[model samples]
Target: MAPWGSAGKTTPRFLGQFSHYLFRYATWLPVLIAFNSYVAQVTWIRGPSMYPFLNPQYNESLRKDLCLVSKWSPHRNLERGMIVVFRSPENPHVTVVKRIVALEGDVVRTKPPYPYEHAKVDVGHVWVEGDGDKTKDSNYYGPVSTGLITGRITHILTPLDRAGRVRWWEHAEREGVQKAQAS
Candidate 1:
């Protein structure tokens, strides 16, 4: 007998058992990938633009905020002050998060670089701005094409106490965002 007595027999038995479970899980891999790609995904918030909301404790810490981004309906209706993640028009290589400040046809009060004092949001376009006002947003760049928005932020999943579903309507009202009328 070996030092562990059943060492030789246990090794082969363990290998056989592990392979069985591995094959069972293998069948579920594609299903998991599909769900992650189409239903929802977890994302990390990395900037100060959405401060005191997302990444609230990120100033000097390594603990960034994690949230759930809903991709269930790629073209779901969006309302003002609702947060979303989209491909950065300036740099397609990066993604950004911002709140919708104005919808199509709504007149927006322009900031410094946008030229005019007020401009109407073009059809299928939206004005997005960062909460912190320190980051580049619609006020810096022109309106974003709605097609670029990838997902709506639906929940915060980190920092323990703040983990829960976000209140989209309340945020919109608090920011004094005018509601989007159905076209």
Candidate 2:
């Protein structure tokens, strides 16, 4: 057999190894992509909006919760009561986490002490609020665009149950519209 024939057989083994590595990398590619551009895994709750449910400032003993926020679905099909992370409309560099109170084409009317002036949520936009009434949310800043939304909270890491996934109903107790009207 010619020397070239011997090299031909060796090429297959190299290619096989390369293919195996590619397969392994493919599995993590989505995660890597999310980590790199779409989702952020580590976040700090700066304010008390999350309140007793998340950050307990009064106790100073209760552990704070860190969560993963996925910006991938912000514009797709965001539903009410979902925990979302978005940029502050007044300031793009700042990020905030709040619950979706209303969506596009919805009328948002809140009472005094809060100034929205009976705003109408526009298309490609959403209304967000903190569970804590004291928080500065849509009541203060008004409706924000879907483009401003970065992601949804998928998991919470803190206290006893670390890596706990955040569910929809866990934050659905408050009625956004009703609360707005009541305010």
Candidate 3:
């Protein structure tokens, strides 16, 4: 009877330990997931798409203004003129930032003054161009797969500003409001 009593006591202690660990993991799981899900992740600008705005080679100070790409609102189709971070279609391992020039089915003129051969927009793909023509972007590769887009440019987080400002812009042709004549 005494031996049986000792075994019973040990069983409760083991159960308590297990419960503590379970609770700890349960509480931490959501936070870990949220941290990765929509939070601003750091990335390096590889090329000159952004130019004087975000240059890795010329302005060493830019290394401080790390681009903050958020995955929060990516499921929605990107608006024209929004800078975005996306996986390179030619190279999945690489990511590039460029502006949305045209959406699916939108006519984009590609001629002189423009640096590349003319191409019409394709469905399920959008035209993206580097603000700088010389950089690697849709100009070099043509339209990009919508699926490749990771997220729109939300903000740039740098220690320079205490507030962490985000320098983003919208096009004159605001989203949802189209030119009546064009339609």
Score each candidate by Cα lDDT: 0.80, 0.71, 0.65
lDDT of 2: 0.71
- Over the full model, what C-alpha lDDT does candidate 3 score relative to the true structure? 0.65
**1-183, model 1: which lDDT tens digit per residue?**
223333345568777666666776887999888887688989989989988778776678889888999977755688877998899999998999998888898777777777777877888899888777567888788899998988889999987899999887787343333444664
Which regions of candidate 1 are displaced past 4 Å?
1-30, 172-183
> What TM-score fits each model?
0.78, 0.69, 0.64
lDDT of 3 by residue, 1-183 (tens): 233223445568777667666776788988877865576566655666676556634445434346667876674756677888888989999878888777777766653444655566777788777665467766677889888887776666543452254455434342322222332
For lDDT, the strongest prediction is: 1
Ranking by lDDT: 1, 2, 3
Error of 3 at 163 (Å): 7.2
Candidate 2 off by > 4 Å? 1-34, 57-59, 176-183
Question: Model 2 — which ten-residue stretch has the worst lDDT?
Answer: 174-183
Per-residue error for 4 in candidate 1, Å, reads 34
- Clash totals for all candidate models: 0, 3, 0
